[model samples]
Target: MRMKHLAIVAALVLGLTSSAFAGQKIKIAGSTTILPIMQRVVEAYMKANPDVEIAVSGGGSSNGIKALLDGTTDIAMASRTMKDKEIKMAAEKGMNPKQVVIALDAVIPIVNKSNPVNDLTIDQLQAIYAGKVTNWKEVGGKDEGIVVVSRDTSSGTYETWSHFVMGKTRVFPGALLQASSGAVLQAVAKNPRAISYDGIGYVDNSVKPLTVNGVEGNATTAKDKSFPVARTLQVYVDGSVSGAAKGLIDFILSPEGQNIVEEAGFIKL
Candidate 1:
C-alpha cells in the first residue's frame, strides 16, 4: 500500500509541473522606443484573448537582444538591426535569431520648442555632434552654446544615429548620454539650449522636430525612403517560436496591430 501511495504522489507532482510549464506567460522586452507601442498592443491583445498572459518591458535594443540570447525573454524588440557580432554569438549558442519587421521609423533631431532654428543640413549636424560647432548661431539659431544630449551606446536609436548621422565621426565626449528615448525627450524639453535625436514617435509639443536637408521626417517621407534616417522597426526571436509567443508576433503583424503602430506615432509596415 505504501508503494501504491508513492506512485500516486509522483503522478500528481508530474501533473502539477506540466501544468505550470504549459501556462508560462509570454515575455517581451527591449527598446524603450518600442515599449509604448508594445504596451498598447498587449492591452488590445489581452482584452480580445482573455486566456493569454503577456509581460512587456524596455531596457534598450541591445539589452533586449541580450535577453533573448540569455533565454530570459521570448521577444526582443529593436529599433536597429542586430549586429553581425550578435548574430555570430547567437549561432555559437545554437540559437538562430529570426528578424521580423513591424513598423518604420525616423531618427530625427529635436530641440527645445523655444528654439528658433528649424532646419539643419546633414553636414551641419555632423559638425555640431563632432564638437566642431559649439554655438547654435553656427547652424542658424541663437548665439548660445549647444547642449548636446545623446542616447547611450546600448540604445538602438543611438546606433541608428551613429551610423546615419555621425557617419565616420562620433558624438563628442562632452555630450550628455541618456539611457532611453523618453529620457532624451525630457532632457531636451527641459533645456532650451539642448539638442538631441530620437525616434519620431517620441516627438511631442514639448520638443520641436528639425528637418534634415529641407526634408521632414514624417510618415510620407519615411515611407518613400526620403527621410535620411528612416529605418525599419523590428523584433527578434530565437529559432521557431510557437504557442503564445507566436500568437503575439502574428498579432503585431496583423492589420489591427499595424493600425496600433500608426496610432502610436510610428509608420505602419
Candidate 2:
C-alpha cells in the first residue's frame, strides 16, 4: 500500500513538470517608446510563469498595429491610440482590436545639455518646428542656427507632437527625421543645436528635457494631465484575448507590473 501511494505521488510530480514546460508562445511588436518597459515586464512575467514564452520587438507604432491587422503579432504595443481608419480596416478584416491602457507618458522636448535654453512656450515650439524661428537665439538660446530633429511620419510620437505643438502647421521640410525615439535622443545628444522630442521613459541624461510652458514633465504632471503632451501607452489585442495573452495583459495591469512601469520611468496607471 505504501509503495502504491509513492507511485501516485511520483506520477503527479511528473505531470506537473510536463505542464510547466509546455510552451504558450506570445508575440508582441510595437512602439519603440514602450519597448523598454515591455522588455522588463516580459522578463519578470516569464520568470514567474515558466510555462509561457513571449517575444517582443519594436518597429514603430504604425507598423505594430499593421502587424496585428495582418494576424502576425498577438499584442501591439503603442504610445498612441489607434486611428479611426485603422479601426475601420480592422472591422473590414473581421478583427476586433481591444485597447488596454498600460501607462501614462509625457512627450518631452529634449536638447543637448550644452544648450542654455531651458523652457519653451507652446507658441515658441510651434514656430521652431514650423521653420518660423530659425535660430536658437530667437527662443532665448545662443546665437546658433536651430537644428530641428523630428520623428518620421510613421511614428506615433510624431503624431502626438503634431497634435499638441504644431496644430495645423507642418514640420519644416528641412528638419531631420529619425525612425525611433532612441534615434531622436541620440541625434539631439550629439548635436548642440539639435532639438527633438520623445516619450518620458526614453529621456536620459545625455539630453536635457526642456520644460514646456514653464511646467515640468514628470510622473505627477503626466498623471494629472497637467503636462501639455501627456498621453497614454497601450496594447491592442485582437478580439477577446484568452490564455497567455490575457494573462500577460492582466499582469501588466497588476500592481507589481505597474511597479515595472514606474521603474521604466513612466507614470503607472
Candidate 3:
C-alpha cells in the first residue's frame, strides 16, 4: 500500500509541475536593427508552441537594455555588442547579463542606383564622407557634390561605422541623418548622388553596396572572413532567467530558429 501511495504522490507532483510550466508566458523586447530577423523567429516559434506568448518591441538598443534592467523584457535583442556601462549597470542590480550571437550581419555601404560608381576603397569612402572628396566626379561619377546620408547618432550601425571606418573622425557636414536602417535605405534610394550605410540584410536591388578595401559583399567573402564591416547580432538576458525565458532561448538557438534567421538574410551562427 505504501508503494502505491508513493506512485500516486509522484504522479501528482509531475502533474502540478507540468501545469505550472504550461501556464507561463514571456515577452521579449529589443532593438529595431534586428527586428526583421527576430520577428520571423518569434512568429514561427509561437505557431509551433501556442502556449508560449512571445511579444517583441523596438525602442532602440538603449531602450531594450533599459527594459531588461527594469524587468520589463525577458530578452534584449542588440545589434551591437553590449557596452561596458550597460554590463556594469546590470551587475549593480544583481542582474547577470548573458549574450548569444544569433547571426552575422554586414554594414553595407549603399549608393543610389543611378550613380555610376560601383565600389569605393576604404580611403575613398572616408574622404567622401569627410568632405574631402565632395564631387562625384572625383570618384568617376557626375560632377555634382556627393550627398552624404547616415543613420542617427544613437544608431548601432552608425556607431559601428564611426569606430571601424571613420576612426572617430566627424562626418562631412550637410549629411542627412535618418533614425532607422529602413529610413537610410529609403533616403539613399531617392537621392541620385547620395551615399549611405545600412545593415546588409536591408540591401537589395534598390541600392548598390560598394566594396570596402576591395572585399565584395558575397557569401564567399563572408565565409572567408574577407568582408570588412560584418558584425554579430546579439541577444541578451538576465542570468537568473528560467522557465519561459530559458525556453525561448532554446527555441532561438535551435536549428529551427537558426534556419529562420538564415532565411531572413542573416548568417546564422
Candidate 4:
C-alpha cells in the first residue's frame, strides 16, 4: 500500500511539471505604426500571465503578413487591410488570414517646427509629393527647396499615403525614403526644409503637423472620418487563433487594451 501511494504522488508531481513547462508561447510581428500600442499590451499581458511568453517585432506590415503566411509568426500587425493578392497568397499556403480591428490612425503630414506653412489642400499635397512643387516658397514657406521624406514601400502607412494623399500617383524619385515612422520624425525634426507624413501618434512638439484641407488630424477627427488620411489598425491571425494568440487578441479588444490604445495617441475602436 505504501509503494502504491508513493507512485501516485510521483506521477502527480511529474504531470504538474510537464504542464508548467508546456506553457503557451506566441509570436507577433509587423507594422511599426502599431508597435507602440502592441508593446504596451504585451507588457501588461505578460505581467498578468507570467507563464505565457510572447515575442514581438516590427519589420513593416508586409513583412509581418509574410511571417504569418510563412508559419513563423502567430499574429501579424498591420495598419491597412490585407490586399486581395496577399489573401490569395495565404490561401495558397493553406492559411486563412483573419483581421481584428484594434484602433484607428490618422496619417498626418509633418514638417519642421520652424516651417510657416500651417495647412495644405489635398491638391497641393499631391503636387508637393509628385515633385511638381519643389520649392517651399511655392507653398507659402521659405524659398528653400523642399526635401521630401517618405516611408518605404514595405510600410502600410506608405500605401495609405499613396492611396489618399498621392491619389495613386507615385512619390517623386527624388524623395528620401525612411523605413519607419521614428526615422521619418528624426529626419524631419532635423531638416528645416524637410516634409514627411506619419501616424498622428508619432507627432510631437519636435515637428509640426499640417492641417489637411482645413481639418486637423486628431483622435476626434479620425473617429468622425473627417480626417481624410485615416486608416484602421488591425492584427491578422491564421483563421481561428487559440492559446496565447487568442488571449492577446482578446486583451487588446478589452477595455484595458482600448485604454492603452488611447494612451498611445491612437483612436480606440
Highest lDDT, which number?
2
- Residues forming the 10-long window of minimal summed lDDT in candidate 3: 15-24
Runs off by more than 4 Å, candidate 1: 1-22
Please give, for residues 106-201, the per-residue lDDT of candidate 4 as tens digits: 999999999999999889999999999999999899999999999999999999999998876889999999999899999999999999999978
Give me the runs in candidate 3 sitting further than 4 Å from their true place. 1-23
Instruction: State TM-scores per candidate.
Output: 0.91, 0.92, 0.87, 0.91
User: What tens-digit string does per-residue lDDT give for candidate 2 at 148-167?
Assistant: 99999878898899999999
RMSD of 2: 3.2
What candidate 4 gets wrong by more than 4 Å, as runs, is 1-22
Q: Which lDDT tens digits does candidate 1 get at residues 1-269?
A: 99999999999886654343355588899999999889999998776556667889899999999999999999999999999999999999999999999999998999999999999988898898999999999888998999999999999999999898899898999999999999999999999999999898889889999999999999999999898999999999999988777777888899999999989999898
Residue 103 in model 2: lDDT: 94
For each candidate in the order shown, give its overall lDDT on alpha carbons.
0.91, 0.93, 0.80, 0.92
lDDT of 1 at 70: 96
Per-residue lDDT, model 3, residue 27, is 67
The best-first sequence of candidates by TM-score reads: 2, 4, 1, 3
Which of the two, 2 or 4, has more lDDT? 2
Query: How many pairs of residues in model 2 come into backbone collision?
Result: 0
Considering only N, C-alpha and C atoms within 3 Å, which residue pairs clash in candidate 2?
none
| Candidates ranked by lDDT | 2, 4, 1, 3
Better of 2 and 3 by TM-score: 2
